[model samples]
Target: MRITRVLGATALLFALAVPPAVADSAPSPSASGDDAAPTTAGTSFRTAAEVEQGQQATASASTGDYLYWSFPADAGQRPTVRATVKLPDAHAAQSWQIDVYDGLRRRQACQYGAQTRTAAQGAASVDLSCTLRTVRSWSEPWANDPLPGTYYVRLTALNVATADLGQPISASVRVGSKDVGGSAAVDGSLAEPLVPGIAVTSKSGEDDGDAAKSAVLAGLEPEDGWASGWWSDRWVWTAVGGVLAALAGVGGYALTRGSGRPGRVPPGA
Candidate 1:
């Protein structure tokens, strides 16, 4: 009778402990999520000269690849432009082209590059073992005169022999000169200064129409820095909860058996 009672108590304690375990395993709202739009830190022009030479330029290609420009956007002011390219899968891409564009999607500068690895070579490669590596990279400084105002960037990928798969991905940003006083756009209501880098504020009110028009003319996108998610995130929490439940069950079983050992004396008895 005593042994059975102890077992019952052990099971109850385990059941109680299981809830906490599951709670711990539960995924937080921030976890298991994809990156949203890029955050604006506001415009920061180091000197007056940079703001004066605002020229709108672009970099793009016929083939998909990477588009990059150096920061400090002033032609004579900054050095070392860096850029990122998100490629499709290796098997999905046979050839690549890169381009830079003005705000209007008109080509400004371009470079052609290709990356290919045999199925055997890629399968045997180090990068694709676990995570999918589907991105390319490029960077160049303002070796040429800096053109400011607004710029559009893009990368396109294609199948080797055919032009059928013309997947183009692009982003837009503003490049103000020092004359603009290193500008930033806000919702006009938030009145919050964006970070010190050139930015195109998405949030706009009637009062901000002028700023918005100027930004759009310069080729920057009106982004509130918010975009809907592609997939529901609730599943992530469900998965985390399931894991915790299992852990709690295991811990409870262990503790129950340990505490229910028959060797201990009962004072009430």
Candidate 2:
């Protein structure tokens, strides 16, 4: 009876202890608040506004238009970006492409997955998800390190017909970050969020002087070494908390079982 009671007590304690730890450590679901409205045309990186991680944003564009968005990241963090695009039913099929670029406007390799539907099938839409692995920004001078800074995501329509030139398409974007357990310290800071001369210039080299000035005034530069330190990763701490809680539960169960052994019965008294 004593052994049974001890085991029951231990099980109860473990059940009670584990839940709180898991709840505290697990990543919270991203809020389903009102969609964020995209500000600039987002055709270029310079005009792109910062997107808060895990928040959804909405934008409107035509076929062939390149929509851009910027996200801040740390060196050791892996980020996943997703986009859902809604198109007009007038077209039978369409192709879309999304790309990720680093601070220097260099393209970063990513894994891409997509789902497409035609108007006849129901709604014309495409869902895209891209993931980039952890990057070490300062590892080498010539390497295109996925450094911590403002990263750009550009979305383009590939097969728009001439008749669909002015048709409006809507897009929703979301970004999520996960820590891959790397060094806490970052190497340096970005001098400016807008990539120098790249922001205001069109592919044909046409310049928007006013847009350039406004970008400078926006003061969007993140603090130097902003990605540094272990505390940045909340998930890491949550995982650690869960592990400790499990260990404690096991230890408590063992100790209780040892102590609740009925005192050895005093030699069969």
Candidate 3:
């Protein structure tokens, strides 16, 4: 069927007026009041400080130390990471970088923004940002789609002069997200997010970071108007496509169906 870009887009905007149903809405630990203040950065993923969306965090450390911070992301939300580094003055040109990893440690591709930047020699500060694609409820194993879960942001220096090895520097980070509503949501959803479990040592001292899973998996609930009755953005596109196809079919039939009926089979045959 023939369709125009304008019509397709119009249908989409109209369809997006409605949202999708949320399977769960309980807040994640990172979103709770327990972490009312910004948490400190961890040296690694295991110790990474947790922060809420839009909350800012500051850290002081050596030029070569790796700073890690984590935040939660729900389906239909696109999260972005912005970081600023206070480079030590009098330092040689160096490359500073920020990377985001998912629960399975898969590196997420930056959709836009300066994920890495090289500070000119003697530069006082360097700023970098990375915006990731919208999170999906579930994805195929072959696809590297972003999923709802805890995401980590790791910032470090790619190269630095030896003289700057122990130089102290200050850094600040902020993680935020914007809900796309149901525009990007899929038909299916996960029962809960992929929150990794922390290993707690036992009183008997038998296990220590070896193995055990206890963290409860939780899904985000849709907003007030997005109950089960609402529809996803995909449905709008499907409905529009179907309408266009039907119109095309009718037009084709009308054009081909001649005004003159088949000359009545020669009266006698």
Which has the better lDDT: candidate 2, or candidate 3? 3
- Positional deviation of residue 228's Cα in model 2 after best superposition, in angstroms: 2.5
lDDT per model, in order?
0.30, 0.62, 0.72
Q: Which stretches of candidate 1 lie over 4 Å from their true place?
A: 1-72, 75-93, 103-145, 158-269
Q: How far out, in Å, is residue 197 in model 2?
A: 10
Please rank every candidate by TM-score, starting with the best.
3, 2, 1
Mind giving the per-residue lDDT tens digits that candidate 1 earns over 1-269? 55555556556755654422211111122222323223221111221111111222232232233434322222111211123333333333243333333322334432222222222211211111011111111112332322332333333333443542344433222233221111121111212222222245455535586775565322222122311212222344456567667656765676667665478688997
> What's the number of clashes in each of the models?
35, 0, 3
RMSD after CA superposition, every candidate: 17.7, 9.2, 8.6
Over 4 Å off, model 3: 1-35, 198-269
Compared with the true structure, model 3 gives a TM-score of 0.65
Give Cα distance to truth, residue 227, candidate 2, Å.
2.3
Tens-digit lDDT track for model 3 on 78-104?
A: 888999999876899999999999877
Candidate 3: 10-residue stretch with minimal lDDT: 213-222
User: Per-residue lDDT tens digits of candidate 2, residues 97-187?
Assistant: 7788877788887854552222332257888878876655355668666776667888887666677667788988887766654334344
**CA deviation > 4 Å runs, candidate 2:** 1-41, 115-123, 183-225, 229-269
Point to the candidate with the largest TM-score. Answer: 3
